[model samples]
Target: MTRSLHDRHRAVLPDWLALYYREPIEITHGEGRHVWDASGKKYLDFFGGILTTMTAHALPEVTKAVAEQAGRIIHSSTLYLDRPMVELAERIAQLSGIPDARVFFTTSGTEANDTALLLATAHRRSSQILAMRNSYHGRSFSAVGITGNRSWSPTGLSPLQTLYVHGGVRTRGPYAHLSDARFIEACVADLEDLLGHTRDVAALIAEPIQGVGGFTSPPDGLYAAFREVLNRHGILWITDEVQTGWGRTGDHFWGWQAHADSGPPDILTFAKGIGNGMSIGGVVARADVMNCLDSNSISTFGGSPVTMAAGLANLGHLLEHDLQGNARRVGGLLIERLRAIGAQLPIVREVRGRGLMAGIELVRPGTDEADPQAAAAVLEAAREGGLLIGKGGGHDTSVLRVAPPLSLTVAEAEEGAAILERALRAV
Candidate 1:
């Protein structure tokens, strides 16, 4: 009977579709940092649905808002603005401190990025875009174009005209022992050279904290220097906050604020946690730039009432519960513990990242080469031990991504670290 059901399920879902390799357990329900499989076996969710569930699964307030809004209205075309949409946009703009910022919402992070790229090129009338090496933006055509990973492209596909700049001078990882001054200088020089070489560059796009790129944070002064260069070249700086926004970083409400010493970017894109796993993403642009765009660019399903309600509720919960503070406190404990573990384990190369968005880079014993096999072993072992984690990096298998919900407790963080240590030992 089980075999027959599995066969039927596989038949219903198209076989040609890309398969995201999942564990054998079929997850049926989730709450606060835990998930249950079909057999009622509970597992600790360290990945938090790839960092999209910022608040946690089925949060009470978010669910209530979603239920109320669903009863009222679901969606209306952009032809008419609704109360929830208006209020949600206002809250986002206030939180971001981007005055009179105009928001254009989408159903997913990829679409949000695609729309932002379109707006950038449309406003500037430029075709060239600058992106950093090892960056992972999104999967849409234009987004894929600016993404630095060549492996993301399919066979026989032509590469986009986007110029690439080295993230840091040291070919080593972002945490390598290098002077901040030298690193920023090298990055600025590269940007200047790239801008000088390429004509009609529309924007320079980057993630505040590099998510898939080993969860790397650039040198201290890198953003300020980059902003100066973009200003000189008359190009806009677009910050992709899809993975880092919504107070996941702990120190600030938005990741960009962590680098507030640097001037704000011209366009900021957010998704993932904005609606706490509800399908909603937004692009907040300067008033002048948004006003310059034509009305025909609006999306039919952007900022639906249900999505806005969910987003608003999520934001309110974050502020009311002081979840960002919890992220900082618990994340600090997790980082310290992981670093201690890495100090003893030869395979654990580095433990890096801010707040809840963190990564552990696995390396071969006694070699600098990435041990993707070992990383996979650790991940599998963690799953077997009732913990779920995600993977990120250029190899897609080297960095063990750990992004628990902001509501995670210190005790839970300790338990997760202990599980990770055991998994590392088994590997």
Candidate 2:
């Protein structure tokens, strides 16, 4: 049955839509931190469906709220007053650090980011943009234009003139060997040097942790330093918190706080975990930037009643239970265990990340060359060992992404780590 489905999917879906594993399995349902494949196999979910299923599978609060809202209205466009949408927007605006913030909802991270670009370009009256190296925002035309990874970028054409910047990947770039202060200085100097060569720029956008770039990040406060230079040029700062928001990063709720010295970003975009799989995405910015457009704007399905209910409930559950605290506690244990395991494995190049969001980079034994083959082998092995992890990297998908539900428990973390250890050993 899985074989037939795979064949059917290949025939119909675009080839660019990547699927996991050599023999793909259809996940029929899930609960808590685990899920069941079509073959009735149970596997511990570590990647949380690319960090979208944040709180858990079938979180009762989100489920109840979604169901209740569906009974009333799933969507009514943006033409009428929607209580749930307004309520969620109010909550998010208050949480967002931007002064006098205004929120605009979209259907996905791509849309949120695309909207941000429109605002930045219109407000600054410039189409030039700065993006970080090895960053993956989304897959829309505008999002891909700023994406720095060639593997994910399908075209060189773009409406915005995007200049790739340094400091997104701490280890792969030219400043890898530098200390934290020196690395920040090098990146800032590079940014300043580049700005001297460019025309008017709209914004400097980045992911706090480069998600598809293998959970890679620069030293803390790297962005704060760059912010100083961008401010000099009157460039807007946009933080794409799609994967790093809602306390997944352990020490901070929003990933941008790692550079808090620069104050709040001019614009912030988020998706994934916010809805716990309900397709919630939006941008929050100071009123001036968010209101830059003069014409009418409305999202056909954005801020739908059902999705808003889900976001409100999911955000509520995440905070009421203090899942951020749980991520710090359990994720710390998990990272320690994985680092200890990686120490014994030659193919493991690095174990890096924060809180529940961790990455195990694989390389050829005794070499710096990325070992995508070994990563794939370990992914398959982990699946056989009853674990579901994810693989991603700029170097041909060579990083193992381990991000479970924020509610992950200590015992579960240990269990997943043990299974992952055996998987690596098998590879």
Best by lDDT: 2
Tell me the spans in candidate 1 whose CA falls farther than 4 Å from its real position. Answer: 1-23, 155-160, 168-177
User: CA lDDT of 27 in candidate 1?
Assistant: 75
Q: In candidate 1, what are the lDDT values of residues 340-391, reduced to their tens digit?
A: 9999999987898888988899989998888888888888899888888888
Which candidate number maximizes TM-score? 2
Residue-pair clashes per candidate: 0, 0
Taking all chains together, the TM-score of candidate 2 against the true structure is 0.99
Candidate 1 TM-score, C-alpha based:
0.94
Local distance difference test values of all predictions, in order: 0.81, 0.94
Minimal lDDT window, size 10, model 2: 1-10
Residue 70 lDDT in model 1?
Answer: 92
